[model samples]
Target chain A: MDRLIEAIAATQNPSVVGLDPTEALVPAQVVASFADEIADEVEDAADRPAAQLAVAYFEYNRAIIDAIADIVPAVKPQIAMYEALGPAGVDAYTMTCEYAQSHGLYVIGDIKRGDIGSTAAAYAGHLGGVAFGAGESGPYDPWHEDAVTVNPYLGTDGITPFVEAATAADKDIFALVRTSNPSSSEIQELELAGGCRVYEHVADLVERWGQGTVGQHRYSRVGAVVGATHPEEGRALRARMPHTFFLVPGYGAQGGTARDVAGMFDDAGSGAIVNSSRGIIGAWRKTGAYSETMSAESALDLVADAARNAAIAMRDDLRAVMP
Target chain B: MDRLIEAIAATQNPSVVGLDPTEALVPAQVVASFADEIADEVEDAADRPAAQLAVAYFEYNRAIIDAIADIVPAVKPQIAMYEALGPAGVDAYTMTCEYAQSHGLYVIGDIKRGDIGSTAAAYAGHLGGVAFGAGESGPYDPWHEDAVTVNPYLGTDGITPFVEAATAADKDIFALVRTSNPSSSEIQELELAGGCRVYEHVADLVERWGQGTVGQHRYSRVGAVVGATHPEEGRALRARMPHTFFLVPGYGAQGGTARDVAGMFDDAGSGAIVNSSRGIIGAWRKTGAYSETMSAESALDLVADAARNAAIAMRDDLRAVMP
Candidate 1:
């Protein structure tokens, strides 16, 4: 959290680009460019298309990362988008995270993974890394992610392993508190007999989960994901969980404006980072600069430029609403 | 649900083997056996260990699947275990699922994935498969799963896509209701203001989510995961979510006995499929027949034999408790 805070301060931007790629989000020509090479490399004809698309996704993400590296402090690569393509897509996800990190940007893997104690420990390997060959030589990090989003439905034991892994690796974990989607209210807004809503209880647990691991910035290794759409709740949560940072999503394409997320920040303007996925990555689609006849290189160039512009606009949008 | 129910009836075993492999669970000699081949295949020395382990996990799972194919109706490969090793492990997970399905066993991927509407649709691709090149000739099924486990914290929208995918693909999804872990009580057992517990509300949701998708077995595509650890509560839920099939985890290694899970079954013994992970897959280690000096092939033979015997024992144990 300290590292992310400082990176935000250095960039003077509190936004993370969501590197969530889809077939529609990525340029079609770029996917086409790899068909021949993939068809040659991949044995099965059924697999070649996904393999090609996976390669195209990496290229698309790489272009965006390079475009916004200096402006954005972090990038959130949603794993579901990659996992949609199976193993090949998963490779692109790790490659995207590694590429983002190599460019001095923090990578927040939006996996939303949760299970019981022992299983959570395995998932925590995203932070704890892996040791193969004998124990003496190495614990190679396959997923170069700084923080990952976790689901807290299984409670404390499910989260403890991630907290431990984050603490050990000087990384962080953000538990999903209140998501931005329409049906999020179904469970998160349920009022408990204790009077607090379920998400509020989760907010308190998230604060406690980060207790002993507060960094120099006064935020802990555990963070909370408070959707930008819930301004009042996000504002209240900002006060309720003082030690926890917030990863605010649902801005831009999801229809959350700067004013909606403004209250999620602290008085010092440092407690939260807003994420805009399709908004930034898919900016080229809205720019009207894309042409179907364009070469793969030219389309990527357009994607990169459009993303950089969108990221800068978002930065200014947040700055205008900052305390 | 019909496929799974029929498979269970055919084998007379309402049990799914959990193919969750860890370094300790896998025979060391088996992993060591892949060292030379992986060293030649993988360029980086740091990656050799996980790559080797990933290959070993596939082989280990193949043996278990082969040995238990005749006795067990399904296999639930917990994705987190494969995820611990990164992309290579993801490949193994898909491979394991593919192999198990090829062997005439229903493959239940214990992914527990959940997200917002669009994102959840992407995760649903685990059941729906992916269309790469032109969407014309191939919606290639990369993940050969008959069903997948999902988390229910995000409510209806997060679940609807999986339900839709399952309905379209003739597959199924089991949402987490009352998890097996001790800490699951924190949120799940919270008494809501509505007189029922939070999990009960979720149980109702699970039942309703499957309304229009009922199968020939009198169950629906959307199922519930009620832990074997909670007998009385699970018994209550068995009555609660009648149309929702149950994927009951925590059977053996988690202190859940056949007697404990007996109440989770329907009157006809058709509603639930229990899972055993380390209890069966790691049974080879507990067998006095295992030795550090045994060859990798011999260790795998022992693993196959132990897994088959364990599967038979579990079947008999559960049968003894059935109505």
Candidate 2:
């Protein structure tokens, strides 16, 4: 938690770019380059497209990471996007994590994994530690993140192992609280006994879970994923979880503006890090920054620059609204 | 849901072995055979143990699947154990799912994945469907599964995509309701304003989510993961969600006995399936079935028979109490 806060302080931007790549976003030239590389695999002709696209996805992530590593404090790679492509896609995710970290960016694995006790322990091991022998822990995984997002539906039993592992390794986790989706109100906004929403109850638990491990910044290793889209809930949760850092998703393309997310932070503007995926990576498509007269190759060459500028613009927008 | 129930009837067993392999469970002889296979990987000396164990873990899972494929209706491969090994581990997971289904066994991916809308759709695609260009759907992943376990923390938005995809593909989902872990009570058992537990609230949403897609057996494709350890809650939930199938975990090793899990089933003992991992795969260690006089190779050779017998014993135990 301290390391993440320090990174945000050093960068003067509590913003993390989300690396949720899709085939539609990958450059045509990059996909064509990897075509032959996937031809020799022992799969049917039908399976070759996803295999080739997986390699291209990694190359595309590398380009984005290299472009934005200096500006953003972190990069959150959503695991589902990579897992959709199969094992090779997982390989791409691993490589992307390694590349981003090598470029001095903290990585938050957006893998919302939750399970029962023993299985949760295994997941904790996958995130930060690996159990080699009884009562003996091996070294932490290099490919695993400094932090990871987790689902809290199975309750504290599902989350305890992760909390223990992160405390031991000085890593961290962000538990899903009030999410950014439209139908999230189906369960999250439900009225509890005293008019407290379900998300409030979850936030209370997250705050209590972090009480044992408060960091120097008055925050704890246990954080909350309070969607930036819900500014009212964000304000309430921020006050409720004074010591919990927030990983605020739902910015830009998800309809969360900088002003809407401002409430996620403390008065010092230091407690939350906002995430934007398509808004930055797909900025060229939305902004039409590249001229229509440019060839596809020329537009592809300028994408990295456009993404870098989009990230800078986001940082400025956030800074303007935050205290 | 109908397919699962029919398979259980055909096999006369509502139990599924969980392929949650860990390094300690893999016999030493199995690890030795795979040491050479991992020798060329670009890993440090510290990583070799896990890499070798990953291959051995796959070998161990294959043996277990082969042992019980004829007796059990299905097998649930918990993704965490395989994910602990990195990309290679995911490869082993994919192979295990494929192998189990090819042996005429239904495979349930115990991946408690949940996220916001767009990301959740990607996960749904990973489970059973994939979106290609406009109006086109790619080939379903054979390495995927007949069903998957999902965490419901992000509310209805996170779960809707999975339900839609599963219904369209004739697959199903098990939403985490009352999990088997001890600390699950921390949040799931919390009493809401109307005196319903948080998990009950989630169950209500899960039931409503599948309203448009009930199967032929008078049950919805959406299911609930009710822990066997909580018999009282299980009974209550069964009465409340009569049309929802149940996937009960926490048998044997988690201290959930056959009688305790009986409430999860219908009067005909047909609506639920139980999962046991270490209790089945590590039976040799518990029962002392492999003679101490045998060589490591001989003991490894006998593991499959031990596992087969253990699975049969579990099935019989459950049948004795179910009806």
Which candidate wins on TM-score? 1
For residues B165-242, write the lDDT of model 2, one tens digit per residue.
Answer: 897788899998988888888778877888898889888988887798787887898999999899989998988887
User: Residue by residue across A1-323, what tens digits does model 2's lDDT show?
Assistant: 99899999989999999999997776566677766768876366656777787887887788788889888899999989987877767888888998898999989999988887678888887565775622334464845588998877777878888999898878899998988988788777777777788888889989988888999999999999999889988998898999999999999888999999988899998899999998888776765666656654565556677789899999999999989
Best of the candidates, lDDT: 1
Cα error, candidate 2, residue A68 (Å): 1.0
Which lDDT tens digits does candidate 1 get at residues A4-122? 99999999999999988999998999999998899789998777778888999999999999999999999999999988887899999999999999999999999999999999999
> Model 1, B1-323: lDDT tens per residue?
99999999999999999999999998899999998999899998877788999999999999899899999999999999999998889999999999999999999999999999999989999996544543555356788899999999888999998888788778999999999999999999999998899999999999999999998989999999999999999999999988989989999999999999999899998899999999999999888999999999999999999999999999999999998
**Angstrom error at residue A273, model 1:** 0.2
TM-score, structure 2 vs. true:
0.95
Worst 10 residues of 1 chain A by lDDT: A129-138
Using Cα atoms with residue i matched to residue i, what is each candidate's TM-score against the true structure? 0.98, 0.95
